[model samples]
Target: MTYDISLDKKKAILLVVGCILLVVLSFFAGLFLGAMIQQPETVTAAPNSEKPKKASAGAPAVLAKKLPAKPKVRLPVKPKVKLPAKPRVKLPVIAKKPAPTTPVATKVTSAAAPAPALPAAPKAKPEPYPYSIRLASFNQFKFVLTGLSQYRQKGMSPYFAKVNLGEKGVWWRLFTGYYPSRKAAQAAVTEHNLKGVQVIKTAYANLAGIFSSKNELNDIFKRLDSQGYSPYIIKDAENHLRLFTGAFITKKGVQDQNQDLKADGIDSKVVER
Candidate 1:
């Protein structure tokens, strides 16, 4: 049987086929885009997988083979530059100090000189006069002066000394002459008919003179010493210096010294200590 299709029916069948083909083409294009999107993710996720299950079977074999594998990125390598070596500096060597050597002692056979002899000791000074007569003691100096003046007027050369009796206060002691013994003092008191006077044993020396200037006393002392006389000094309470010579122990010895001093033009008195 011969089928006769008109031109309009033929055109209508061609439009329907084109529409179906477009739908199928659209579906395949969607699948191909989905596969392309998932392929990189799968490769990134499991790069070592033998088979990528996510690959679409509908994908063309020629496109798969033509796709380039991920190219390995070679980072630029830094070349090692050889730097010049630093010059070695030679350190200066320090010289060590030599140790000190001990000196050797040498002995000599010659005789050694003897040491010098020491100076001889000086002679001891003689003792002072050991006896004097203390006539009376007064508490007030004026009274003692009055007594001294009265005694002087009566042909007696009297002297006074100031003595501190500590808790008893200071006293002015009146004396007439230096005596070698208490008996000699008593004899003098009796000869003078002195009353209320007692003999006291004490030390005294012959007084040459009282001088205000120590220089004058020293001059006189030197003169006496040069003349072979032993002279000494005593500072009185009045700040005056009294020069004395020869501390005699006997009345004869005192008289002899007085005579000798007189011969030498030195005036002295045997006043009380």
Candidate 2:
């Protein structure tokens, strides 16, 4: 039967077509699966890239495994800070002393400057005289004054006064009253059991001559023209003109003058003034 028997060819063609279809189906399936289950993109460093940190596989636990980085030996750098400047303080200036000008001007300026005022000192009061006791008088005798030191030792300031009775004058009357008042003097006299405490006014005298004639007194006075003796004359109660050389409290003064008059052949005596 020569009937058109193309079965082998048809089977070959079918096999070829089946193989082509399987290839196309596998390509489309792979494309669709790749698109559905896509993986995230990973960035990798180059081998020679200089990074301060080591590469990590995106894992937190990998930090300890990272190689220790090169220790950057940083040098110490000084910080630039501005400081406030110190303020200047003014000092007091002392003026120098100037040279002196004219001597008159120097004197004037010195005089112009007032002296330092001193505090007033308390004024001292005058001392009252010491109380005294009047002892008896030795009318016919001279007071030797040898007992004066003894009286002073006994707390007594002893002294003498003369009572003039013209030619009959009493002897030096011993006393000690430099006392303030008569009462004080009386008290001192009573204390010492002293009697006859008569107050005596201060007196002094000396004599060069006692002449009956004023002419004889003048002659003696004119002869005593020495610079030492001051001579003067007065008529006494006896109507006798007595010439005095000087007045003195002490008898020794008059006695000495009497000795000097004796040297000059002129006699003298002491009297109260």
Candidate 3:
């Protein structure tokens, strides 16, 4: 017991050494096993860097490519046109003026004309006086005095007395110194175209317009004065036979008075004064 108990230090030393070697061996084996359990990884490049190749210049011959076909179209043709013909126009011609002419004269004859004559003178007759008287009238017998008065106032008086026809109721009258003699009274009555100039005398006076021959009314009175009849003259409106007594107008008045007077066997004449 004692003997082993005192075992050798050297061996102990060797055992310690062997234990360190076993630890180191275990670390190295562990490191190699961890490496062996892991696989080895291979590395590769990017896929973009590996591309396919393009066609080469030395490929097989191919045929030329043909063009596409186009659609067919036709163009239209145009027709030709003709124009109308124009007429030709002509101009008018002008005219010329003519010349002037002269005038002519003719001849005449004188034997065909007539002649002229002269004038004559006139002749004359002898002239006389123009005188007149009214003879008598047949109405207005009642106014004999009145008539006599009017005639006397006008320078005329009754040459013969007034005579009355009693049955006829009329008067006869005469103015004074109107005649020269009986011939003058007769001539005056005939000239005046009067009727019933019974007896003529230088007694009666003249009135105007009984004679157209002369202006001798006063001249006749003067002639009667020279013949010695003192007859008075008058200018009275009532000296007519109507205002006197006998009332004689025409020849018939005197004739009727004469016949009446004759029937009574009494005669009276209407003598012109």
Candidate 4:
């Protein structure tokens, strides 16, 4: 055995070469083992980083966005609460006037209030046309005044009228009145047919028909005119128409005319005017 492990130059050189090759192989193996172990460490680092990225993306569910807030400030509402309108002022009303018919109603009330004082006011009036008998008209004022005074002494109410003509003359006519009417005055004239009473009352007349209608008197007037009798007309105090003879003033002349009118188929009478 000692003889077989003998050192030679060639074997010694081969053995040293093999030892170098082993050392090189060992160094490469160690380097390969370290690289495989470090690959697991890199895979572990990638899985750890992916877990953080997934966690960061899912964390956005808790968003910090703010919602719309209610308006708490109310400045415009305070101005609207203070605003109020003023009320309108009132005016006065006018009064109305009374009607015009109120005075007429008052007059009717006064008329009904008193009835006895109405009739006493009318009895104090004097007579309008008192009766008068005209005696004679004188040419002088003094003579008629003297006649009026003399007639007044005979229980006659006497007055005189002055007849005036400008620059011509002034006369006075005497009369007696204060009687009732003209009919009574004519009765006095006929009763007192003395010297200076009526100028026609003492005269005679041939009387014709006394007519109440003018048409009846017209027929007689024509008949009397054809018989040559000049007729005259007079009105009595009662306004009655009296037809007579103006030409026959004496009794003998009226008697002759009455005979002539009777013979001519006309009936008549003798009268004193």
Candidate 5:
């Protein structure tokens, strides 16, 4: 052991050792780079191996077992049923009663008998006084009025009549008392001592006017005469000259004549005799 090495040989050995170390390190680095690149491929290939696959008809039993099994689903169903039919029903009928009838009575009729006749009554007798005494006649109604007043003073009710004597003209004849006979009438005139009075048979005569004016009297008298009326003059109690027209047998006849006079615009009233 006591060998002594030279400096140039030591340096030559150290160079050889560093060259070896460099070559080894380079080889290890190349190995590590190859491992890293191959590790990513292996990781990608591992996931592909874990993925599911459909089983084929011709596949092996080992592959069918490796596939996942599917779950089974079931649905519910309804059942059919049958029911019985309903029964039929019938009702009873009712009867009605009849109403009662009433009996009617018949009436009998006969002809009525005629009534008996009654007896006729007797006629009444006429009045007996039919005569009148004609007192003094006057041409003027005023004179007749004065005469009537004198006779009334002597307690005699003297009434006058108008007479148309044709050519002799109109005269106012004063009269008093009704007598049954001319003899009785004469006897009454004598008893009264009536001057210039005569017994005469007289009937009912109408006295139609009692006018104050002689002109009016003449005018009415002429009018009545022209109209087929026999008008004459008489005197009333008030000394008014009145006109007389007709001599009728009945007072009814006088009334009819008065109606005619009224129709001719001469108003007349009934004076009963």
Candidate 6:
């Protein structure tokens, strides 16, 4: 019986040995898987540094206990975002200029340069006889004759011309040889004590205009002096002649002059030439 029990025990021992090898291989594979997991965890923990660590069976448990739990944390609520108000800006003011004052004022000056002078005036021609007058009407022949005599005494000559006006005989009487003006003739007539004395004006062709030349006037007076009359002629400032008295033509006129003559007075006569 002992000899037959030894072969059966050897077959039982091979079965136990195969089971033990399988158990050891499974333990080493479990250890390798743990080490692989530990290597990734170590690499993740030291992202900035390069190092290695050995894996252990109890490492997962210890690491899990040391890790912090996710706390009930409320993310900082975004504070009420309020934009600040914009600052107020002020604009600058520009002052305006005043307008010009006067009507004549401008950019140009008043005393820039003087203008050219104007030309002078021409001289005027002088009058031959500066003064003259006219008489409107006259009456009384005797007064006219007597006025002629008085004019001759006052350094004047008488001219008498007659006109027939119906029943009245109109006498045009004139006096010449005024040194200044016929205003002297009118003044002489006003001062006289006689009646019906009227001043008559002489024309340019009468006294002043007719006797313009000096030699011609001198020749006329020489001829009158040769005919027994003291005739003299003189010129005034305006080159006008003053003819003086001469002898009487009629005898009755001479006697009247002699009768009317004063002590210092001379005879008035009309001498024919």
- The segments of candidate 4 whose C-alpha lies over 4 angstroms from its true place after superposition are 1-202, 247-249
Which stretches of candidate 5 lie above 4 Å from their native place?
1-125, 206-273
Name the 10 consecutive residues with the lowest summed lDDT in model 6: 201-210
lDDT of 2 by residue, 1-273 (tens): 334467777888999999999999999999998876664222333555676776577756543567889999999999988898888988899898898776663466655868644333224332333233455566753342554555667786565434454597645556564455557767766777765456443234466655667665666777775433446555544555556554334566556556666788766665554
Encode model 4's per-residue lDDT on 168-187: one tens digit a residue: 67555455542355566667
Pick the winner on TM-score between candidates 5 and 6.
Answer: 5
lDDT of 1 by residue, 1-273 (tens): 134557778989999999999999999999999999999998788766667456568875554356778999999999999999999999999899888888886665576666544323224333233554566789986787688678879997666555455799876667666555677778888899988887765454567877766776777788886775656565544556667765433455456667778899888887545
Query: What are the clashing pairs of model 2?
Result: 132-176, 205-247, 205-248
Tens-digit lDDT string for candidate 6 (1-273): 987799889878988898999999999999999999999887888776756576777676435456677899888888898899888887787777778666875555776777533322223333334222332234666665676676678655554423334576543433343324567756755655434554443322211112445564576566544543334454544554444432222344334333343222333332221
lDDT of 2 at 190: 72
lDDT digits (tens) for residues 1-273 of candidate 3: 767756876679889999999999999999998877663322223434567666477976565786767766666666666666676676676665665555454333665455422212113221211123443443664454465565567564444333456697645465433443456756755655556545433221222112222332445445433542222333223222211123223445445645554564443444332
List, in order, the clash count of every candidate structure: 0, 3, 30, 1, 1, 0
Candidate 1 — what's its lDDT?
A: 0.68
Candidate 5 TM-score over all chains jointly: 0.34
Ranking by lDDT: 1, 5, 4, 2, 6, 3
In the range 1-273, model 5's lDDT, one tens digit per residue, is 223457777878999999999999999999999999999998899777855776777986573345566666656665656565666566666666666666665443455555433222213333444577877779898898798789889998676655556699877777777666888888897888877777876666566655766775787778776765656555444555656665444565566667778888776655533
Query: Between candidates 2 and 6, which one is better according to TM-score?
Result: 2
Which candidate comes out best when scored by lDDT?
Answer: 1
Indicate the residue-level lDDT of 52 in model 3.
60
What C-alpha lDDT values do all the predictions have? 0.68, 0.58, 0.44, 0.60, 0.67, 0.48
Model 3 segments beyond 4 Å from truth? 1-132, 135-138, 160-170, 181-273
Best by TM-score: 5
Please identify which of the two predictions, 5 or 6, would achieve the higher lDDT against the true structure. Answer: 5
What's the CA error at residue 168 for candidate 2, in Å?
Answer: 0.7
